[model samples]
Target: MPHDQLPTQAHAFLRQRHNELGIPGLARRWREVRAQIRANGTWRPTYDELAYAARVAWRNSGRCIGRLRWPSLIVRDRRHITTLHDVGRELAAHLDEATNGGRIRSVITVLAPATNAGPPPVRIISPQLARYAAWPSREGVLGDPANLALTRLATDLGWSGPTRRGPFDLLPWIAATADGVLHLLPTDPMHILEVPIQHPNHPWITDLGLRWPAVPVISNMTLTFGGLWFPAPFSGTFMASEIATRNLADEHRYHQLPAIITGLRLDDRDRLRTDKALLTLHEAVLYSFEAAGVSITDHHRESRAFARFAQHEEAADRVVVGDWSWLNSYPMTPQDPSWSRYYHPGQPTPALLRDPYCLALTAGHPKPGHEPSPRQRADVPPGRCRHTQPRKGGHVSTRTPVKAHRRLTRLAAAAVTLAAVTAGLVGVSGGPAQAAGCRAAPYSAKFGAADYFMQYDGVEVISYPKYPSYYRTTSQCRDIQVRNTGDGVDFGPFYACVNFYGRSGCNYWTYVPVGQWRNLATNVKDGTKFYVWVRIDMGKYYGFRAVGDW
Candidate 1:
């Protein structure tokens, strides 16, 4: 049946899509939506939720449906998979009856490690395939290729995330709808479901949410695993005007072709005749299909695509890493090291950890290719080494010559202690006590008051206990120290560091080893006397400020 004969709910859903596409005459239908939302006073399935979802789904799908108007193929949509039973059954028959039968293609994207890093997981499946894979479907729903792809992708990403989560979960990005967009809750033992969502009157929830909770990472949030919500706004806003102009182009004749395609390899002079997209981000998919005669319009902008107009063909499939542990393969420096000044430029991505955990060491254990870790001897004096011949202690002797560069690594680890303060306070005590000229003195009441850490010229004894000595360079930091004393609060895996090199990079900087966020602030004692550096969490920025008597 046509859109007019559909029920109010289906009609509302259709109108929303129309409004999003800037389809002519859509406003008349949207009036109905505005009235419905107003009458309800609040949305269980609110307009805000619906609109936002549709918007993002569009972007996620590479704006194929979001930007273009397919005038050729007939488009029919139903709110729930059950609503499209006839179409589902028809599509089902085609898949089964077709010769050289091949299962539909699909994939999943999941967040792993399993937490405390990066954004949430994402899973998507085409509409037709979703129905065949979900509950109450008539076919072999359990082993559908699309479902397997989704599961494989999740497994590859190290998701190990709880399964069968749903509609009211925290990660709206992965919530399930009756529609086929993307749903992967299996009724079998392949995956277990987990959720971070709560009911309004749930025993765990308070009226204000904050009143009953001080931490909300998993306890108070909602999570919808194995399901996805379709969104249209992200793509529309990112490509709105560009698409509008294309739709008006004389050649396309009112089709909302993607704007980024003009520079593509496909010729827009004839799309109906070509059956292709101008410049799809689907580079990996296009090339694979191309071998089978599936050509695309995205000839130029599909940088991800291997096949160019020049005839470059990509491998069969673009590999998405199946493991999350690899993300932790790099060293995360929580502070500066004795070998060099600071971390290499952008040593770590924000996907790593909190900024306070600056200059961190991921996996804590090194695999062959992994970067070495920063030392962890904070209380040790600057430019000094405590050499105790270990008869046989579990704590490895970092000073052993057999260890090669381990001593330098130790001092680098201590360098981190200079900036690991919980409060945004940095103390600077510029005297022989903190620096000892070319050496570091142990913690003392008098010297402790001046928190500034130190590095000197000639021979420099790094702060690590087993770290014997390190030479310095000209205009190199003659000596530096944390600007404060006694605020050595240990925050477990959370710490920050500074190199006193300047607000950002300077001549004395080193490869931050592994850490994210550029130093947002730096000071030179009096802003002119000597430069001071700082590392901090982005949420709580603590610029380099002199606290003690400089």
Candidate 2:
């Protein structure tokens, strides 16, 4: 029971337990852990300690926006169950408890932990407990593109999909147990509760035959608590945007925007048609889940709840670490309280760690090698986050270069009349010679959707970086022109700000309309340097260019 014999992580976890929960008998527990570690090289956590650690892991999960309900997580200890058949049985029970007859309770089932003297712990190889199978064909990928690797792995493991493979086919679970055997177990259809998507106003939208599972159970991540790693699968109800904007509407996924727009018989030529369609799809998901009496949350509500959670954490003297890009909702709006703020950054321990071997196994690659230790696996980087830093002037194109060129040509043609007017205004001033034709390169911008949410694509022009302030006269001012080159959509109510510093100094919100050139004049001293920034306010893809003379 010597202090030097116990690992630092175990001591740290015990100290955290005492500090956070005021758990009694800290000295006795510390002695017991030390003795256990001295005897067996690891110490087992009591059920209460294990449950608290799991809840803390959820509370510390930076990527989850619905962490406000972390305390409500139901932790089911299945450490005694090590065989594949038992693991599958427990997983089914977990699904049933999580599904909760459409109420969708947050639940986690913790299986056997890796030990020094025993066989390897039970591991679930699927990323999620209920993911659709993907099949490649001559036509194209028939199901979720994200699951292609998983489907291939399942097929290789002697798991056959439906007789007639189609979209929305449920995938079987792959589990590797302590018996050194890999097992492919099919998910019971009754355990999967799904709500059919349909719009209240648009009856024809039901023809799309889209449905989503009531609960999303993440199965691949390893839960690390009290210096022990457990294969813990957890679940929660879906955020509507996750299904509507990401899973079903992402270009790499179902890409249902075009189909929904076509179904609505909306003009594709209209710039705002895509925005309307996205809104409709989101609305449909909400309506369908609510009508079915299933639990689901929208981005707006989730954002506000996260803000409250942050407040509570701060009040309890805890730093709320988060990835801003993941916290922000897809199809981001200015109105969300969480959008304009930043959080403390760092991945805290007593958290879920992504094991590379487990990731590979889930992705259909089962290579033979020694599995990396938890310390090695914990170094995995966080996912992509939103970019807010200022970018240099260049032609940023989300589309092909040829399409960008065509848009640039059209932009030039449309700006001809405005250029002529500006030329006349410069000539009429006639005070001193000035650099009146300084133009920044055109840039493209788009709203948050799918993987594009992490990008900062906007029209930005900085004067000090390219053109010095000496190019202008004392009597003359600069007029910044922002032109939208996108397909006929009106973009803003967005801000066009002139800043002496960078984006941080941009305080003014000057609204600019898209599909045309609009001039915003900055009246400043001759030797002053400034920059103009413009970003879209609405949820639609847009292309814009900012040009100004110093």
Candidate 3:
């Protein structure tokens, strides 16, 4: 288990890939890899094979409707990067070349793989080169909801803002080493090219402050092929929906429609405002990119191109599989030919795989608080606070100021206190902390429950200036396998989210409550010390330790 000794099948797999790609020197490469496997229990692909694999991954990506142009991907061989400085330099170059001065070329830069056999390779953590800050506010998310945690992590690393975070702010690059140590990569401001959005038909649309980076460079995905993996950063020109429908129009994102509707003097009170604003926003994205001389493909045009590409693949005897939900998520779906069809999730010769969350935890996020969710009890009215009572059926309703009652009273005495306190309860409320000596200790009920198992211990809250976001684990713990059964949540095993602003700070915490959790001990034969954490939904991420039968 020291190194995944490349088997005979690996050599064949590489050879088939090379031959199918029409690359010369397939036999020589196979022999080279085979000898490396026999001698060192590893295989390092040649540059040609690496480039071919990168393109094949693009072709195999089922969710990307723009894969029709996979052959156009320009691969940069940077697999020799040793230090974080080199990564930043190479990534800047990738952005410059992919930006194409504004036209936006599709390109990918492949980097060094994980040297060790057990964990994933080092990867860039940002979803894109440019992202907004999701600061904690009484108002809704100021920037992209999807990038809230990353924004907080960037701020934690001493990256300050131009000022308070706005709807558009370029985030610095963050990458991890093979060991999972995170490093911040500073990008030269000039290298990031952003285009302001304007609508050709609606002249007033320019008043709305909306913009996006020219290139969508994804850095977190692992490129796996023939028993080898590379932390690859890939870039592509924007498809209109990526900018219009999702980035600009999605409620969690920019939520530009309300402003646009106001600017256009359209009636926003009507339910149809969202639908009308969506089309208008979609048109604005298409118009702005073109006017700015940026490269973009409208969904209708891209869908038509995809149909042709599918036919071309079929003629070559290749089954073109795709994810329908992603393909259909475009605007004016019925108008596009792609909306009419279903696709199989095709297997690629080389796949762009997502790195496991356990590997991601090596970046050193804080651990989670061992707090139980404040479940509303039947005795308490709908809006009243439900504090854990020591007795089975009885409850302690504190009408006293929450901060004052640090200790618990006897159930019979507490009932009398509750009667006196209910009048004052309208103004006073208990904070997160309560007396530990109470019949039921704070969060103890959650741990002692028969069905609830402790995943970690000694979790401490790490403070961020805006909101205390991360938790660090003091105790050692194993990774827990997680299955995201929710349709919207995209997380791996051992994911948790801590929202400081949850219900305006009452009933604020929840862990991996919905997943199918299991112990990874049997699988981790070497006892890999996995530092795991919970990335709560659109909130701060908390680290966790295993609570061993506590």
Q: All candidates' lDDT scores?
A: 0.23, 0.62, 0.54
Cα lDDT tens digits, model 1, 1-550, are 1223223443455454555555675565556544654564211233433333333222222112212221111111222222222322323332232211121111111111111122223211121121111111354332222222223322222223336632111111111222212222222211111112122222231121110100111111111111212111010111211222221121312221243243234565764422233222222223323333322223122212211211211132212111111111112122312212111112110011121111211001111221111122233333322101112321122223333223223223333221122222222233223333322233211211111221100111112111122211222223233333223232111122332211111123321212122221233333332222223322212112221222
Q: Ranking under TM-score, best-scoring first?
A: 3, 2, 1
Checking candidate 2 for backbone clashes, the offending pairs are none
For each candidate in turn, give its C-alpha RMSD to the true structure in angstroms.
Answer: 25.9, 19.9, 15.4
TM-score computed on alpha carbons, candidate 2: 0.66
Report the number of clashing residue pairs per model: 68, 0, 16
Instruction: Please state the error at residue 253 of candidate 2 in Å.
Output: 0.8
Alpha carbon deviation, residue 206, candidate 2 (Å):
1.3
TM-score per candidate: 0.20, 0.66, 0.68
Instruction: Give RMSD (Å) of candidate 3 vs. truth.
Output: 15.4
lDDT of 3 by residue, 105-143 (tens): 888888887644544445676656666666668877777
